[model samples]
Structure formats: C-alpha cells, structure tokens
Target: VTAISGSNVSLQISNLSTNYEQLTWLYSAHQKILEWEFNKTNLFKSKFKNRVSLSGNQALSIFNVQKEDSSTYILRVLKESGKEEEWHISLEVFDPVPQPNIEIQKKQEVNNICHLQLSCKIPDQSITYTWYGNSRALAAGPQSFMLEITVNSENHSTSYTCEVSNPVSSKNDTVYFTLPCQLGKKYSWGWEGGHRVDEVKKDVGIL
Candidate 1:
C-alpha cells in the first residue's frame, strides 16, 4: 500500500477469527511493534509510543506517517487450537507533490512558425513530468521535463499545461498564450535576440 507523508494509514487483517489466543504485529519480521494477549493486557513498543494504535478489529493504524515508517509488517495470530496464522503487508510512504510552475524558456517566430521551448520548474529529479496542450497530451515522454514545439503563428494562441507527479500525488500548472505572435508583439518572458528581457515589445527583425 502507498501512503502520503504526514497522513494516517491503516493496515488491516481481514477475516480474523475470534478464536485466537494472542495477536502480535512485527516490523521487518523481527521487531515487535505490539502484542495483545487475549483478555489480559496489551503491550506496545517504545519506539512507536503514541503514534501507533491497534483497533478492536485488528487494524494497525499509524498517525502522521513519515518516509521512515515505510516497511514490511507482519500480523501473527496464535489460535487456540495450537496453530498460527500470519498476514504480511508492505507500506510505502511518499512526499506530497508540490504545485508545478510552467516557464517559457524560449519563444520566437520565424517564417510564420512560432517555436516554443517550455520547462516544468521542479527541482526534484524523482518526479515525472507530462506536457499538455489544449487539455490534450503532448508528444513529450512521460519523464521529460522540457518540451519543444512549433505552432503556426495564426494558431499560437492556446494554453499549455505541465503536470508533475510522484507515486502518491500530482500537481499541474498552465500557461496561456493568448496574445498573437505577430511582429512587435509584447511578451513578459522568454528570450529575444539572444538576450534576456522582460515585458518588452519584440523588434521587427529580432528572432
């Protein structure tokens, strides 16, 4: 099972019979997390402290989970008939995805074709990025963070979205190309004439 960091997660032992004499939960097969002696007392590990709990239905819950809590857990039940049953569960914890930012790295018009280079501004290399145009997926691969595309000047007024995701969460941001890519049009970002400028009008002969 996969869980987001700082969230609560529960691992349940389903169809547990009532004829069990003792119930125990182990971490990584050796470390005992908790044990319940039937009708007697419950013992919990000091490491877990107040962060872990066992429900009446034999569910193990952890609050405010962290990446360090990801591991394999085993639930062992000692039946009254001298037989033992076990259930194994694996948990994976991942950090929540941050909201993505789309940046125009380069944009220029040549011969009526608008060339654009975009990037998803996320520093994490473990995350995957996907590009979309007008709500449709682009040709960029699932793991690509940079996207380059060309559009006719007449059809350049569209929106492009960048989605960044991990195993547990996803976030996306969009950039709108509402202004025409005509000569002398003003742009707030991207390169012009091999120099970086902001909120400037394009020159008639610059690319």
Candidate 2:
C-alpha cells in the first residue's frame, strides 16, 4: 500500500511452492526485470541492483526507499507442471509535513473563567492535531482541529502549543497568555536645606 522515504518495505507472497521452475520480478513502471531459478538470480538494470532483491519465498524487498520508487510491482511464478501465478502490489511514498499556522479566533472572560478558542489553518483533513499546555500533552484526539479551553486566574501566564502531524512528519506552533499587570505607587518627602521640603515619587509593577 504506502511507505515513507528512507524506510525498508517488502511484498510477501502466500502459498509459496518450492516446485516452481522460476520466479520472475517485473517493475511495471520502469521496465526493470529480474529472474530467479535453481538458487541463482539474474538481475537486470544497474539502477535497482543495490536496492531491489528477491527473497527465497519469492518476496520483493526494497531498501532505502525513495519517493521516485513509487510504482507497481508484479511477481510471476512459473510452476514445474506448466502453470503460472502472479501477484500485483502498489506502493506510494509521501513527503514530510510542513510547519503549521495557528489562529486565535476568540478570547473572552465570563464571570471568573476565560474562554479561549483556536483553530489550525492547514486545509488537509487527513492531518491530526494535538494540543499541549506548557509542554504537557492534553487529552486530545485526531478530530480536534478546533480547540476550546477555559482558564481561571490560577492559570495566568500560561502557554499552549498545537502540534500538527501525520504518519510521516510533524510541526507545531505556540501561543502565550498573560494576565493584566498590577501597578503600584508610593510617595515620600525629603527635607531641603532647613527651609523647604522636596517630594519624591516611586512606581512599581508586579505581576
């Protein structure tokens, strides 16, 4: 069916019989061919000599698979009693997922609870989304494209990240939320040269 790049994959044959006169492998897409008989295999096409192989059970093994290797493969077994059997297998390869974009659609505070909503901008429906809070994984599943979280004053200065991924690759983006900073002021008096008094002011910011 499907395989990613740089991975090894094999196509297996069932009901194998040792009485076969010869086993042949034909790559329908590139016109590459191979034949095995009497424990000896004849390989054609130098391009596939190192990556393609036929096992003892007539299985095809492809090593260090690449995107260009996506094609249909056919295996033909010639029996000693003058009968032939064939197997067809299709392979597909995909690239890694790219970085994702996140949007903060809405944020509102009701009573003492803040409601935050977010969405992923990617259009691929097959991709899955996972939510994390301060590097801790949330209870999320594959269908959670949109997220709704409720935060209170206890959760101020928090961070949330969304990891979008598929079977081959993953990417993520993060957002931070901060509470309103508290400002304070203090006033003090200093004596001038025994006649007048000067005033000084100080301001402080606390989170």
Candidate 3:
C-alpha cells in the first residue's frame, strides 16, 4: 500500500488463533520494533516511539509517517503448537507537492505589439499540471507547464493560474496579464488655399 508522508497508516494483522504465543514486528531498517512473548509486551528503544501503537486486532498503526518509513514490514507469529507464520507488507510514502512557481518568459509591448509566454515550474517529479484562464478550465493534466498565450485587448485582462498536483496533494499559483488595446490609424484630407493637403498618423505603442 502507498500513503502520503506525515499521514497515518494502519497495517492490519488479523486471523491469528488463540494458540498464538509470540509475535514480533520487524522493519527493513531496524530489526525488532515490538514483540510479544509469554503474554507480555516488549517495546524496543527506537525513534518510532510515541507514534506507533497496536490495536485490539493486533493491527499496527504508525502516525506521522515520514519518507524514511517506506520499507518492508514483516510480522512473525508463533503458535503454541510449535508452528510459526510470517506476514509481509510493502509500503511507499511520498512528500506533498509544493506550490508551483510562475515565470513570465516574455512580456514586451513594442510598436503596439505585445507577446507573452509563461512557465509553470514543477518543483518535483511525478507531478502533473493544469492551467486556468479567467476562472475557466483551460487544460487538464498537462505534461508541460509552459503556456503560450495569445493576448488580446478583451482577453489580455484575463487572469491565468497554474495548479500543480500529485498523488499526495495539490497547490495553485496564479498570474495575470493585462495588455492595452492597439491604436488605429487615422487619415484626413482638406483643401487649404485651393491646394490639396493630406495628413496621416498611426498610434499603436502602449504597455
């Protein structure tokens, strides 16, 4: 089974007969963590104390699990009939994903032209990304975090957010792009002193 780091996990141990006389819990790193013999409980001195307990059903519960807790757990049971049995389990733990980092690759307005490219950085591996524009879902489970945007006067004011998620957790980071409307060209012609006069002007440069 798999679980997120810093979360609680329960290792079920059941189906033991009343003849069970001894039991021991073993970890990959440490040998013996807890044991029971002669109808007595024995807890070894380890870093897992205060966070590990056994339930009435003999289920082992580990709290505040950490990355190092990912390992093999072996449970040995000895029956009063001079027989022994072992149960094994494998556990995987992962860290929660951090908030995504938003980077503006391109932001420039020249000659009334603007272009923008934003990047949503994935801080860790095994994570997925999603993009939202103006509170609307734009992309789902995007493999890449780079977003090439087409900024228009009406849509430039739109807001963009990137959500980074993983098996353990999800987080969102937002970015906004506002662009000015492009200016239009105007031309005028008049007659001055019986002479034809023409004037032309263009406006398009603003941030």
**Clashing residue pair totals per candidate (backbone < 3 A):** 0, 0, 1
lDDT of 2 at 44: 86
Tens-place lDDT per residue, model 1, 1-207, is: 888788889999778899989988887677888888956546565566678888878788888888888899899999999999998999988876666656668888787778888787677766777877777888545568888888895666466777777777766666666543432222223222233333333323323
Residues 88-193 of candidate 2 have per-residue lDDT tens digits of 8888755455555556677777887777777765676656788777678774667886778777888743666677766666666666555512213323332211
Give the TM-score ranking, best first: 1, 3, 2
Selected candidate, larger TM-score, 2 vs 3:
3
- Error in Å for residue 166 of model 2: 2.6
Q: Please report the TM-score between candidate 3 and the true structure.
A: 0.65
Per TM-score, the best of the predicted structures is 1
Residue pairs in collision within model 3: 112-204
- The root-mean-square deviation over C-alpha atoms between each candidate and the true structure, in angstroms, is 8.8, 17.2, 17.4
| Model 1 CA lDDT for position 77 | 92
Regions more than 4 Å wrong, model 2: 99-161, 179-207
The parts of candidate 1 lying over 4 Å away from their true place are 40-46, 139-142, 154-157, 179-207
